[model samples]
Target: MMKGLVSFFFLLAGCHQAAGAVNTKTILLFPEATSTNYVSLKPTEKVLHQITVCLRSYTDLTREHSLFSLATPNKDNAFLIYFSPPNNISISINNEDIFIKVDPDVYYWKKTCVTWDSTNGLLQLWINNKRYPRRVTKTRSPIGPQMSVVLGQEQDSYGGGFDINQSFLGEMCDVNMWDSVLPETSVRVILTDQFSLTGNIYNWNDENFQVHGPILVLKDQYI
Candidate 1:
């Protein structure tokens, strides 16, 4: 019995150490909006990670009725991206979140990118590779601190009541994360997807972020 106990303690220590080594990396997901790719990530430290994406050309069906979001099955935290056809962009968080939408009429091509920085608590809007000055919304919760990341489709009803049948149809590429929020200027540069060392980046096109499996989540109330 004594020998067995000693072995058990050693095994437990090893398990703890391994779990501690789970560093937060960029989670890149390109689910068909109908499929969900899930991952559980608890940051070793609090940092701002940039979710890079290149939305595919908008379609009438999806543009009129669809949303892109990051959420967990717990329903405690959520960030929503919704834009109907014509001209309207809005973002709302049930809890700690940030996102942007482009007004098709305002911008002819409707090409733009936005950055959500958890560390600095800022939302950046970029148009035609130019950084536009805009007010940032502070998170009610500090980016959930630690969250189980879910991408592509909604996780049951936890995703702000998003229906799995309504998924985003687009390509998300060159996702990255840094231990700190990026400066406004840096966000403009990286929007081109040619920058090096944005800390950690998951290039969906590169296959670093894959689709398969159920994501993990903490029971904590995030937002």
Candidate 2:
């Protein structure tokens, strides 16, 4: 019994240590109306096998815009989150695009969250904590590194494609991303603006990105 207890304690300690190694960072972006306003990020993890984003969009125009994107240096491989007016939201993984319709209200702020897991190719989207149906794709491989991550403009090529027609013109806050799947409880925390659990790959409190153009900052409650 004594030996078993000692082994159990050791296992617990190991688990704690492993959890401590994850990166937790987040950021906020208030995109300008032009294509020049954007933010860029790169993760040390070569393959973004899984990812999640929690944010609110404040654009009221019925135009196409990009919320988030990640692509290789050569632009050959990529994943993207795009929004089109009249309640359309799309996700692109390795060039395969999947879309879902959302609420059409553009004036009111909306709590939005998206998650993608490459392991099983499960993709999920949540609005105001209410989850939509899940979609699956890109199960064969993971997103490679040396990626150009951007917020606001869609990457037509790898990292340098911007079209004014597809630029984001809105306030985005409480932006968070994780390299793994988040639990139900964590999702709730994010939606309520009481987030204590930090993202393993990107914590908003920590600076992990660069801002370009005229992105602004606003209160977290605006979302």
Candidate 3:
């Protein structure tokens, strides 16, 4: 009886450790060449517009592509992060779009963070720990609660309507999203490849997402 009890306790401890290990594992996505390759997240109760994506693009900056998007059935409530042709990183919140020039050298394996608060209409972007000038937008209302979050493709409509020209053709990993804006220090920690803590809404390791098209799941090589 004593031996059986001891073994049962050990088994429970082992299961706990295994679960923890799985929760911290990161995944990499290799998108398709012609079709859209993406991971569709399960819809949560409320939309969390604050998001971060750590990815690398091997495609040339001359081509346009989308990295991620949180879309709604209504086009007016979507949020997107995409690369404009020739060398620009652009983001669209609701219906307003903002963009900035990107240096060619920093396109490899970078961490980009974006935050928006609908109440104050404050929007900010951070790349690899460097912060950009804050901009205000959409002060009148908050982002709608219904969101269809997808990676590697921009949603022109609700869940479908992917344009091949704006499809991502690289690797993505360590994606996260929070309902509220994270502190500057936490964003810096993610940039350093240490995901000790993460967002509450969509955490890459903890959440399950459906992969569409021909996307390949490779071992994360960057971090």
lDDT of 3 by residue, 199-219 (tens): 577766665678887777665
Q: Model 1 — TM-score against the truth? A: 0.52
Error of 1 at 176 (Å): 2.3
Judged by lDDT relative to the true structure, which candidate is superior, 2 or 3? Answer: 2
TM per prediction? 0.52, 0.78, 0.78
Off by over 4 Å in 3: 1-25, 47-61, 105-107, 220-222
Cand. 2 Cα-lDDT: 0.71
TM-score, candidate 3, is 0.78
lDDT of 1 by residue, 68-182 (tens): 4545444444444455556554544445434444445332223345556544546655645655555366653434333444344444454334454545444332333444445
What is residue 93's positional error in candidate 3, in angstroms?
1.0
The alpha-carbon deviation from the true structure for residue 142 of candidate 2, after best TM-score superposition, in angstroms, is 0.6
Off by over 4 Å in 2: 1-31, 74-77, 218-223
Candidate structures ordered by lDDT, highest first: 2, 3, 1
